[model samples]
Target: MTATPPHQHDVVIMGGGLAGLTLALQLKRRFADIDVVVLERRAHPVPHAAHKVGESSVEIGAHYFDTVLGLRPHMHGAQLRKFGFRFFFSEGRRDIDQVTEVGASRYLSVPSYQIDRGIFENYLGEEAARNGVRFVDSAMVRSLELAEDAHQPHRIEWSQEGKTHTVHARWLVDACGRAGMLKRKLGLAQANAHDCNAVWFRIGDRITIDDWSDDPAWRARCEPRARWLSTNHLVGAGYWVWLIPLASGSHSVGIVADPRLHPLDTMDTFDKAMQWFQTWQPRLYDELDGKRHLLQDFAFFRNFSYGCKQVFSGKRWALTGEAGLFLDPFYSPGSDFIAVGNTYITDLIAHDRAGHALEARAQLYDQIYHSFYESTLALYTDQYPLFGDPEVLPVKVIWDYTYYWGVLSQIFFQQRLTDMAVLGSLREELQDCQRLNFAVQDFLRAWSGVSRRRNRPVMLDQAALPWFAELNRSLNDRLDDEAFKARMRASAERLRALAMEILERARHDNPTLAAGELGTLLAEKPARLRSDAPSEAMLFEPG
Candidate 1:
């Protein structure tokens, strides 16, 4: 343990979880002369296999880890390359191929990973320290002394090895995750409308989902590569079960559901989760029944989604990761938020160090970050039931993926988080997209309400969709200011056309349905996919 003395640091970060460690590394990487200290309550070398629940990474998170932090070597070596997201709408039946599935036939150019949190986080902590960050483990923060004045440095008091130590910092960031030390103390927690819960556990042996089927054609769908490497989800109504493989010969099985549908008590415990699986996911239950004794750990959170009233402050304090806000794990956006939040925080710190106007920038970042949070929340708020409908869910997934890849992914990939000029130029377009998103979310709920659960044995290959695959691969392309703006404008138009498609589909299902903001837009300007562009009519049509 490092000796602590009322030390003065350029930045002091709390809770050395994924968010905290990553923030420290990012800060150190940008400003080498800056002294950063990270305080983690957990001891070093945390046990492998069952360290944490967020073991899956989507493209945003993976790119952040690989390109942003320049840790591709560690990611490729320590983590399992994700084989894209595979979903089984089989519900109860063990015949996976017989049930309708939504996934990629081949891996997309964009990369993600099935992260073993234990291994990944451990590496992050070590990497942070190795890269000139003072990462202190076995730390328990007892009190915080946040500076009220703009030019004052914040103060932190923590305990390590039964010794109380004090540190002063120009910036104090809360990356402590759910502990939310600053959030609780400052009363920044704001309850979101998205009330969902999750329960998950890891097993000692691998749960090879591919072996569940014996059909030669089924096995041949994705050949040579192992399906177990993919982050598999057995999706059903109001809940989805995730099967993530760990590098340490273990499988992470999780049940994330809407409490309104699947009561928390029904599957809070390991035994109850197993029994719940028996009813909804018999194959997984059957696999775990024999190895119940080898249960490594069990955890559950009721109403995990939340919003923060304030995270970025002009007072030289900020929050990142779960310490500030978290939307959902369905798309594995935890690490992505860390990347974004850290990016904004770093920009603010850079401006402050250079004695530029920070209050305006801070307020702008606050609005932008929270807006991103709200946009993401729209996808999940009261949208869990759609997970069960094989038909509607596939379309919803495509829409969601398009929105994700089109707008947000482009901003981050092109490194435009703090570009005020670009953001201002696209303000009207973004506002329209937001309104369209709200309308489409409501449409999806309404459509799912009236939709039928058709479980046809059709494999909707996301990679086969040329536009969709191109979107994934296009992230690597280098674009200039003009090209970037053009790309964003194109994405916005795509969303507008998509809104029209969703509206038509909704009206097709329910002739008496009324339109909202999107409806008005569609009324003024109809959603017209280009002649060569893919149309929704045949994508999810009766296959």
Candidate 2:
């Protein structure tokens, strides 16, 4: 090992990926005079080819970067600016399609953006440097030295340029994505043991966004098209393709499949993956149309899980981003989660610097953070069938209503408070929904009963209204029953109208909203949700 470096820092962050870099920037911003060092295994500004995956962001996540961290100005030059997500569920044009806007305003509430991951990370690195964080490239952290006292400072050993060095820090952060070097070294790493592995790459020239009309409202609001293609066709197994637009008119596309449905071993090399993509993703295959260039090489991973039980060990160590939790990317929450984690870490660091007792706060953060992932796991693992079922359509519709209300609530009411409370509430809701899980599962098993036999595509009708009304009544009790039903009717009408509006907006290429504009919608009370109602009360009941 090379000789130890002579200097020490207040914090040493491992891995220079999104989470690492964001925390580095946030820490320096909050504590300007503290010495912060970032160790990255790759050389400066890691060269990553543009890819189709890792393109979408959720509203809650975007708010942190744009408003909380104040990185919006820097992100203005990103390849794509997305208003919300547009989901399509089949290979050909005849599949189920839905669009959900993610922001706060009824007129201007689109929630997130899409961008090239490589470019975005590069921008973060530069921003971190500007904020006074020292980023050391080509240095891989091999192991950590726990302070002999176990409560004192810790030492980090890393290698670069064929030399080994040790550095001491009052605090350490692990932002290492996927590799989990620090996590493994600390013996905090654990397998998810549930999710399947996925492989992805980007194909350029074969894809284009011109076929997708720009929304004038979206254009005015600076919203870019972030398209995702899911599958209900082509053998009907679980797999998806995504086509996201970037700044330079380039597109990113990739496939995510269930290992049991589509094993990667069948496609061992980049060529095999491409061939599979051509066979499965017709639009992408047609777009490629003989193109020979690849923006990214093949990348794969096995079934992933979340939660690093010990994200922060005492006063001097913490984990952020993927190092802390690796939720399934079905929601496209990568950057958002990283940004949120960084914000929390910065808050803790600030508290420590102020000499307050932070152990309680740290523990609270871990639980809340764990709750977020746990809630996510529940949704993806247990509730995912809602997306593919018809008999459970009413439940899915109600859930969507709940989801939108929850998003609005967070932005308007919960923003000023701790996230733990919000997540804690959600955890309760998930537990309450556990009984409903079997109902949803049964619906999935008999999906063909309603879906396949239809002579014409069936859209949800007024029959779903009562269930939604009951749900609304159960969740909030301030409004009278009649008034609550009216509100549900209104919200449902609005959703239907919004669907048409989205189609028109897409056709005309218009952008309708801006960041931070959704506060208006939240100002109005949603359909009266009753505190004493079964669903609402069940959600808050003792677990």
Candidate 3:
């Protein structure tokens, strides 16, 4: 930035948290000789397992750690293998399983983890250093000087131990979480419609969901019955409470809500959060009442989901993780995006170092990346109002997961992320899913408006649902290109049929309900769905 700095590395990454550390390790692993430096603001040995909020991983992020990054050994030894997601729609009930619950009876075929952020980050830092990547701790980045010319290197200035330092690099990456250092410096911040708020705390010991109920039938629903290992959700109007177990025997509890309905000020403190829980989720509140003295930490954030104007650029700079864009944490996608964005950044640097033109690829990546972000955003934005609708919310969950596993997840698992021709061919299908998502979200809102909350006591076992279970197992299929496309096409048709089923159920429940956008989507005759595909029976089946 100032002509040139005295000392330089091939790449300089800011914010040595999860994203930065992972990227550093990835770069060194891919291009062994490439010089990389990671600057972290906090000193190491931050804490044990309860360091950060996001500890759970879904499929894509889990795959990034296990298959792509080759961290399977550590994953099995140090982290907890996640039981599939569980949701309890017991708004005011003390008996949890007696209420309408949706979850799997057995583990899914694929793998994910309940990560202890501190433990994972510590391991990543050590691995990065061991693999010849320079990891600097307690280092604060002051400024980023992105070169106007694509061919020029970027310059970064940082402060460490009361001393200022400057370094130049061919590539600069920002992985700072919410700080968004470079994002704010360049005025790249943009707002989304999902103005959600969150409050989370770590308990000193595990708050086992299983211990809350003593009904033998409820406990026997699972095969290897251990409900506490799952990322359990206690849902109500406009909010959901997450209870995740850490490897250190502590539990991570969070309450994320639509700010308008459940104000952040209402639950900003431990006591306040307890009161809110007691009002909405009495079962969870009763469970935590005895453990109040063992509370570890509490924090809150308003409007956590956001967008960035530009993440990747031909200007030799890129943004990753929370420094770029953040979708709602409803599904824990932060690490998945880190895996994806980090891969793209390293790929760009690799191309540049090999003397290849990367401008076109960067542009394409940006378009596709933002497209993915926007598509996922549709799942959470303005959808929180339906969180407590026991009938519609369950249906919404099925459809949301179908779209996720079928479209985006297939691309990731098939290792076809950068495959433009494939993405182009599936353009119509992806667009349909996005449009369908918007329509369904609207329909749920309308459905919730006219419908009543049937907080009935019953376990809606997800594993017993044939098509749902099939989709979960299908993730492991080793498909050729032909079969993959066929599968995707089948998935799209299934979604179409699923939409029809959802619309029909809503109409049956609310005779006076206006179909709105959902009616319009169903008006257009979809292509004939497969005979064996899911039907209305599959969607409306009893547990």
**Tens digit per residue, CA lDDT, model 1, 36-88:** 99999999899899998899998888898999899999889888999988889
Q: How accurate is candidate 1 locally (lDDT)?
A: 0.86
Give per-candidate clash totals.
0, 35, 1
RMSD after Cα superposition, model 2 = 10.7
Which residue pairs in candidate 1 have backbone atoms (N, alpha carbon, C) closer than 3 angstroms, thus clashing?
Answer: none
Clashing pairs in 3: 98-457
> Which portions of model 3 miss their true places by more than 4 Å?
1-5, 525-527
lDDT of 3 by residue, 1-543 (tens): 222345678989998888998899889878989999999999996897568889989998998898888899999999999997889987777878678888888887888899999888999999899999888899888887888786677878888888888888888898888898888889999999888999999998888888788888888888645788889988888899999999988899999998889899999999999999888889889989999988989998888889998888877789999999999778889888988898788888888888888888899899889988988898888889889888888888888888888877888888778777877788888788788878987888888887777766777777778788788778878887777778888888888888887777877767888888877876875636687577536574522
If the candidates were sorted by their TM-score against the true structure, best first, what order would they fall in? Answer: 1, 3, 2
* lDDT of candidates 1 onward, in order: 0.86, 0.53, 0.85
Cα-based lDDT at residue 212, candidate 1: 87
Pick the winner on TM-score between candidates 1 and 2. 1
Measured on C-alpha atoms, candidate 2 has an lDDT of 0.53
> Which structure is stronger by TM-score: 2 or 3?
3
CA shift of 169, model 3, Å: 0.9
Model 1 — which ten-residue stretch has the worst lDDT?
Answer: 531-540
